[model samples]
Target: MRIADHATWDRGFPVKYLLVQEDEDGVEQLWGRCTGVEGFFVDPVPPPREILTLRGCRPDGLLSEVLAEPDVSLRCLGDVCVEVCDDEKPVQWWTLADAVVVAHQPHQADPERYDIVLGAGVRSEESFFELPATSHFELFAGTRVAAASAGRCSGVDGLFKARVDLAPVPMELIGCEPAEPLLAALRRPRRSERDWAYLLVLDRHGAVMASRSVGLAITGTRPSVLGGILVDITLTDGGNDRPSLAARPIWAEWYQGSPTEPNLWAPYDS
Candidate 1:
């Protein structure tokens, strides 16, 4: 498993690595252990710390410039190939036949660093056939197994949702502007008067403030898709609080109206 943690300054810097861990309760913990060397900023220009090769069936020039370089290490635990490289150096690479990989990344300025991990596993092959007056017989024959049976066979089977411990970083408000770019991308033309909700805090200068998980919303749209013309907005404010303000013209979903029956909503919460 490969795991990593990193941060970027407003001035830009090299992508530093960190350590991360998840407890039984699914809480993510982050620790920073390495400081990036100066002159590591490659935001406008590519860095020289890692590079890509054609050795492991990875065709050269077949990958994206942003994804080709090894910004972080990666590994596979089962029947999967993995390669890790930076701008100029190849860090680590491996393949697994039947295993899992876990990657961890840590937040910056932590007491420790964690690696981002990815896990993989392959299913065993099995064959079955019905007995009859035949010369050959299948290696395995039986009724169709239920999905529950396979789940039971797994040693530790369950979806592993990643947890990230976002550090309290200084967020600068760039500006409060309409999120027209976002709405255009969504291809929703009928949306009218979509405005974000939140405070727009700024720093000492005219520069905007920045923070994590600050509530922002867009309200204005006809009820339509889900029943009537209703404004559908998404709020993403779940990190530490900092100086910030809401921007306007936030992208939102257009709901048509309420549901015909309240029972339909029950399954969603469950």
Candidate 2:
């Protein structure tokens, strides 16, 4: 487990770390403990030098470039992996394995930053899960996962694979615009008004690993086959909520749509 109370700005300077905190009025303020590094910024606000100590740090998707560097240490907190920055001991940490439910809470100051709230052992239907707040998993919620395998496909060279897990209900895929080159290589004729399905691939812990929308064609009568051009994968960085994918994999599972979750309307005939 890695914990951090400060942010690191990796410029070629003696002091590369700074503490970011909110004042009593809830405004973000930068604080420094070191001396003789005033050339980098306008004001070097001072704080209690004695209490300013380093500790273990957590690295998220923003640090993807940094994590790719040679010999960066890493550790896993539950299913999420984080980069190790310093030798200091971590002050706090949490595990997803112990969580019964996970809720996403966006940071007030930074819109991109969100904290993953894990519900304790108790399971309740009337909690934040029932709130009107946008539930990211609303599409597949209350639906069962059906396992289907995909083979290594050709002509999908440039496009990355993004798996869409489904429930029993059929739903439409939203927010996908494939490049012209990919559309031209497909065997079927492309159309502007064609219906597409939005898909999401989640890790075992229910963290969104990747998502995309693809124009799928359903064929046959009873046992129908679904075909679609693989779209470019949109990898997510759920802030400190989940770990990022190391690399894209081939053929993620696509579940069967159910009527219960009407979000994804079933296009196949009975």
Candidate 3:
């Protein structure tokens, strides 16, 4: 299945949609729908609309002055930490990074393992009022990959699984280890053809993250809708032994004649 469109709700927001189609033997066969978490950020309070005139204020000096000023509110979403400037003077200049702070919380009663860092501001929005500087500020959150399921056929047995190693690595990679007899089972083809394909990656907990109705071609036919197919793609481990899997399903369909397209038929002898 190929994605017809992938769209997000808005800038600095996380909502999104994935549209897919499946075709086999030149005919449309099946479809799939999947949804999951995406990361985004919003700044409710942007720099003041009116520009503040700093006749001789050096850029650095202006920022430093603003740092000491009051009326600025900074909050970290992941750790839920809020910092407010108490100085009465207005801030003249400020670096985006300096204004933001990550709140690292230690495990209660235990100092080794961190409970969680609240510095992440995914899906959070900020607001700005009349201020002392003219600057563009952007909020960004790291990307995360999650899985969701669409439609499936009972004839397509077997599960898809994947896992992500928390450990660091040079590059991301996905590996597939099919059970023995995989080749024979797949080679002994059927007359109807397998239109839908599934890719499953097993996580540490054995849960599977699957992408279904992926598009692929088979037997020299270029169907409009295609299903997922498995290919041997390697990823650099970067020095880490463990890695997560990226799996998706492929579906194919036979072609049906369109209203304007001419139909060709072979003569049948009776």
Candidate 4:
């Protein structure tokens, strides 16, 4: 995403949509994890206006900043936490080695995980507004961070990132011997023509509930939509095989005195 005007500081200008130049692309078939099913997914349309920060910039070559996906909110990254699941365990805690601040995904065929490529998990530090001045963690390439279903909000169908760093795992917080099959799934990868992919880091017992945006809209004069749809999608952890499931049409729209942010989108495909 590009800023409307980089010349000024806070409240200077609104942020534009992604894919302005020939190189900007959300479907990273050329290039491009999850705590739960909520950690995966994206919106194909112009994403909701969001604010992002460079985690650990590379001094020479490697670029750590990546586009996770717009389905995952940038501001919400402050409350995310990583965790692992097993047959004998509820949810085991894990540290976020890498952080995925914001991004957007657009995969419809997938009923489970489809937004991993968009990069919308947690900030891996704290609230988006409360990040430390000094940068740490990996700065060259993307790092793997395992999180849990708890990361996504159930009511809003959005995610909640942790504002503080990951806490230590209890000595007894481990599960029975590792389930190789489950472990393999957690670290699995996806392939798609659109490239809006995500890994199914779930056991065979749950269903993944996801919601993808199908339209593009912008409103209001504020640099950003003043509290548009907080996309409160607390992605619950379940699989397609779950005995029961529910879904509803969630809409997001905004309007104000003047359109502050300039929105853009590449007419790539239908």
Among the numbered candidates, top TM-score falls to: 4
Local distance difference test, each candidate:
0.25, 0.24, 0.24, 0.24
Q: How far is 190's C-alpha from truth in model 2 (Å)?
A: 13
Comparing 1 and 3 on lDDT, the stronger one: 1
All candidates: TM-score? 0.15, 0.14, 0.16, 0.17
lDDT of 2 by residue, 58-124 (tens): 2234232223355333321222211111234322221112221123334455544433332222212
Q: Could you tell me how far off, in angstroms, the CA of residue 36 lies in candidate 1 after the best superposition?
A: 35
lDDT of 3 at 195: 28
The CA-based lDDT of model 4 is what? 0.24
- List residue ranges in candidate 4 displaced over 4 A: 1-73, 97-100, 106-113, 117-270
Model 1, which residues run further than 4 Å from truth?
1-176, 185-201, 213-270
**Predicted candidate 4 versus true structure: per-residue lDDT over 1-270, tens digit per residue:** 222222112332221111111123543211101111221222212123323333222222112112333334442332223322233432333233233444434334443322332233333222233222331222222233532232221111222333433322111101111123322322453332332222222222222222221110111111112233111112122112221211111101121222245542122221
Q: Candidate 3's residue-wise lDDT over 82-148, tens digit each?
A: 1112235322222222223222233455453222211121211233323324332212222223211
Q: lDDT score, residue 129, model 1?
A: 20
lDDT of 1: 0.25
